[model samples]
Target: MTWTLKLVNRQPMKEKLGLLVQHALKSGVAAGHLRPTEIPLSIALETPRIAAHGDYSTNVAMTMAATQKRAPREVARIIIDHIDDSGHLLSKTEVAGPGFINFFITQEKWYEVLKTIHDEYEAYGACQIGLGKRVQIEFVSANPTGPLHVGHGRCAAVGDTLAAILEAAGYQVEKEYYVNDSGRQIHTLGRSVFLRCRQILGDAIEFPADFYQGDYIEDLARLLVDREGAHLPDMDEEEAVGICARFAAEEILSGIRKDLEAFGVSFDRWFSEQALYDSEAVRSVIQDLKSRDIIYEHEGALWFRTQDFGDEKDRVVVRANGQTTYFASDIAYHKDKFERKFDRIIDIWGADHHGYIPRVSASIQAMGYDEKQCRIILVQLVNLLRGGSPVAMSTRAGEFVTLRQVVDEVGRDAARFLFLLRHYDSPLDFDLELAKKESNENPVYYVQYVHARISNIIKKAEERGYKHMCWHDDFTDLIKLPEEIQLIKLMARYPEVVAQSALLMEPHRIPFYLKELAAAFHAYYHDRNKHMVVSDDAGLSAARLFLVSAIRIIISTGLTLMGVSAPETM
Candidate 1:
């Protein structure tokens, strides 16, 4: 059954952490006391809406008390008593706040966490959960009818980063872009371009009012003129429409590639929708549906009885003119994806397509696949902002801001970071001016600046000639500070954060983790020069060096997961 598992096994990491907690609880139970999972080890690793919880806190004991038919405080005591005292950074452990277990870690642990950081600098927080399972992520599949706007950019960033995160966690990943070039839209684009070309050639032409109007149209028209110049004879409606469609499709696809490249989005596949047509997959699908009685004649057109499979209304597969609808090709395309033997099919669609979920899922189900295997994410629109005011962009008016414009205006790093900083479910307001700012007022800059600053500090330390000293040696004895210990525990949680982000399909979690990690690093660095860790005092220096190393590695790991560069020196 396992020719080779090509998907990630993410449960192991969760099991490992859970088992550690379980071991502590088991030890408490052997003592004949009410042992529960609620004893919080030092430095609460919790999601805090209120900042004063001291990192992570656990109420597992309280919850278990009701089930075990025992008192909450009694169970909490059982957990606290058996916790391994070997936790060096743990300073004070207490059962508090309604049977919750809280532990304070020593600051020296933070320094040691730095050492752990340096020890695994190349692979800090990396996990083997994926086990090299193959995963394909398809995103930013905007129709090549127009330039990519901020809306498309979000899908690009999120899809790319999700792939990166999964890859970092040990998955074999592929990033793909699905091109909608074989649809009615492409024909419209061609008809539009052909008329523009004929007009440019001084030929009498009636332009279609529904054709795309953009300055880029002139460029495409000129390109056609460049390629066909003298050979271009007078074209009739049929000849002009076909020529225009092919030319516009090629040019627009090229533009899409260039724009995505400008924003650092690379795809392993630019699958053609027309491929479905060329391969006769659409015809085959229609025939198959007809054989299954899923197809019926309606008003001289062929309609798919999608309603039988849960669609709100029956969908027309073929018009009276015998032309295929976009949905017909889409069904074939998704069926094609499934036939590719991909264990999972992920599509990052625009929010406007939310209503299509039911039909798409139903089709996949009807095609003999689990509906769950076809996952669609609808990312809300990104409202571009400048100086706290919304910047409305309309492609119909040819006033849209391209992905290139955003990347060029703010640099690729900031653009990608800010786009993914907010939960994809929420509305993200991307401020061009704020992103372009050179100061730390921007969250991206603040996070990146911390990495750069750490690099500088490490460089300065090496310049002072303490490069060979054991970074974590002195930190062992120094791992007694509360702030330092808190940071170390945070370092240990990076893998957890990454695993959660991957599971939730939320890339924003990575950025949020980086912010919190940066805050910890900044807190440690702010007054360290005044209360310096004498780098030459071998023990103290090594300890502090370890802390520095941890920060560097964690930053590198976080940045890597986000698909951003973590420079040694910013």
Candidate 2:
């Protein structure tokens, strides 16, 4: 069947109206009246956070007035006159509050949205803005020197969730981790492990203050002794450190993958810094830069004139010590990512690495690519709280708790949910005891309880013979409840939620949206006994049953994206 025919059977009214507004606004611009380079069509349909204003409101007229040379009210009136929303979804459009167009969709349209919830459940909350293009998302590329801490945990969750959101919106997305094995830090890691190996061999080696002090280092020492021998025959510290670093990296990376797996974070690939060097991509990229005249030598060190491309300062591509800088390897790595045919590449880095953003973009643009094609999502630090006191996490003292330790103490569900509780850019304060609490006071438990309650509702429906009743339009009277309409309206907005999360690179929005949806289910459940599903009417019960099932599916879909559980029974 043709797409137009297919859409006629299924597309939601909100999507159609959004398209009309976009087309109409651009048509207004083409008619020699307005211009829209500064603002987009989306700002014109943003709903006020305070629900009393309207269903959705926008300030398109205000945005276009500078080009129209007319008042925003006049622009809004002209646009409204051109709009043909025969459906009551556009019940009224008025210019209000400083050139804003406020639109109130009708109650009947909101009620009709229930049919959309069920009709599109399999492909329910999806968008096609990506146009089937492949995107690569690299995140939590921490050094494999030790276990990941709570701070790294945030990036892992954010990156993985963003990938899920993009995939849901029909993008072919790949999740990757950049392994920093070929760096000076790995040499330092080797030295730290070898010290532990010496201690295991009964040698009185003085531990350096900067050495890794985690118990895992001692475990690596034991592994080396068990696999090799008790006595070292005149081996230099450098050779021993090399062995230790190699062994430590393998063990630590294995443990890192296991920890992320337990947290439901999986990657499609683990790209290596060493691999770039081995493939000679690094040398090829450096040669390409030299051909472009962006590379130069000053005081025996090679530099890239990144300042010319918008970086704050020139960056060293190679230090005077004959070793290339990490920044250079990064440029090569990003070039490889782009050359692999991904339309977009997203890098999720820790907030501490915020300074690296400008140089990376400058390098990308200097290599003849648009700076906008590269995106870096910087996640703020995660403050760990246990019993209300801040848990001191010092890597120098080896006092940092591993991601696995956090998961063991609390759980995968609690850790995953809490990591995604805030905006991706906002600093997350993760409380351990609060996460483990089984009471309704725990936010994770509170959200999961709603899912469980709805599961119970489904069982009650079956016990009341709803299992045999065919779900059709005739039994939609129960969905006519005010609360039922509210729930449907929330579900109807899921596609937009997914789209926003992907475009803004904020996957935490998914968890927040899930919480709001679960809140609706909880409020409805709290009123279940009093609200009376029976209502002395069969149609009411059927309609309520349909709405409850719809909510359960949406909640499950959202929680799954975050790797959190949707328990059938609390």
Candidate 3:
């Protein structure tokens, strides 16, 4: 299976620097200072923490000293001396710490980053690492038995942002929601709604101990009575339960769809678990496993030899009573995904499913597919807090806050922003009070304020009789202040940050990067001695406007990726 490559349209500054460093290393070998055969397979360049150290730092010499049979400092000197600076990309190269070669990019060259952002606009951070490979991300596959709670909201935010990130990195991405409408959960939903319906028909029936107790069940009951009241009363209990189940499942799924859509999540597919059973895909998978000697009858129940493929134990695919396990449907679902020819399949499951990972991986291997073709992302629980008190939630008893309620309370922007503010695998403490605040302490407001502040500056510039023009004007040398240089450097790092986030499958890094960029812009704006955006010198004013425009572009691009908005005004 060959995938066409869609390389980045704009060459990143880091890649260009890496190429320069590689060229210098080869030059050193050609000049006889280092052995050509001893060249390392890969070279790494990193940004130094202290601004005084340099813009970029590499420790290749230190790692290669033993291979080249020379002192680390001598190797560093050889590489630095042979480095070509004719392009004037580097201001100077110096040896720092034992053998670290630090390259300081020319201050004027950093301004070119602004031009790249202006040219690419919304595509400033987009790259092409995935290169048109088909990848399907299945996330927020909550069963249609209830409303999506705050935890599911986090999963939705993470999954949606990850899809956007992968698309930006040039993957042919499809987002999907797996509907678990075939299982025991659906039966429970139906039974719960049916009991409520009997009550609506004036029956004094007591609710079961294990029945769903959500108010939404009452809504589904009312809906079912409205649609099938006359027919339901005439039917037997078993037949009515089936009708109630189907109606309740569809209604709950509709509500789930609306909640996700309101929270800015959309899926390319909504796969039905019952469809697998209806089409006999589940039976076929079991038969295939049996034929491959991967399945055996143990105590009258059919079992898959998952223990042989790294699972802790063999798992039952079907019980003796002829009921299929959820595991069976999951195996068929994954098999169906691979049959669709996606090069990569990602399943975002809740953290409680952590133990289920090895078995699923085993299932893929058992089905004659590479385990590496599938990746499982586990999203941890969200601890909803109000002030300092923990919010109580029990989904079975329906005492939890719905995701829609959170979005309505704090607005969609804040809800989504806070959800991704922390790593998905780590437990997130969502403070209801803070998320709704307009102060700088709120992360969403802090980052968004930078964007709004930049907009105000642009508006102020236009009011001063200087209309903002296209960013093709040269202002590279005009941006000389240290704060201006810092902001440009941060903006230049946006593409690399996005690429790293996509490669690592960590969208949380984006919010952290945005915070840093926002802080840099705030510092630059508050520098007392100069009016950075509006000035007497038209050249400097244009230059400052260009800087603000680049900042706005990067912030908006990142916010869009997180499904959060970048407002023009506060």
Scored by CA lDDT, what does every candidate get?
A: 0.75, 0.80, 0.88
**TM-score for each model:** 0.87, 0.91, 0.96
Instruction: Tell how far residue 375 is off in model 2, in angstroms.
Output: 0.8
Q: In lDDT terms, how accurate is model 3?
A: 0.88
Model 2 lDDT per residue over 233-347, tens place: 2487688888888889988998899989987899999999999999999888988898888988889998998999888889999889988989989999988888998889898
Model 1 residue 36 CA deviation in Å: 14
lDDT of 3 by residue, 1-570 (tens): 122211321577788788787888999988888977666655788899998889989999999898888989898999988888776889889988899999899876776677778878899888888989999999999988888999899999999999999999999999999999997878887788889998988889899879999898898888878877656757887788888899988988999999999999999999999999999999998998898889999899999999999988999999999899999999999999999999999999889889999989999998889989899999999999999799988876789999999999999999999999998889999989999999988989999998999898889889998885565445766777777788888888888889988988999989999999998888778874684578888888887888888888999999999999999998
**Model 1 lDDT tens row, 1-570:** 342321112222233334445666777666756534344443223533443554445677777788667888777777677678563535666777788776554444445335444555666566677787777788998888878888899989999889888876777887889888876888888877777887888878776557788778778888888888834546567777788788888878898899888777899998888888999999999899889878888899998777877889988889999988888888898898888877667889888888887777767777777878777988988899998998877777677888888888888889899889988888888999999888878888788888888778777777877676454343466655657666776776777788777777789989998899998878787876633544556566656666656767777778777667777665
Q: Give the TM-score of candidate 2.
A: 0.91
Highest-TM-score candidate? 3
lDDT score of residue 423 within candidate 3: 89
For candidate 3, give the lDDT of residue 334: 94
User: Among these predicted structures, which one has the highest lDDT?
Assistant: 3
| Pick by lDDT: 2 or 3, better one | 3
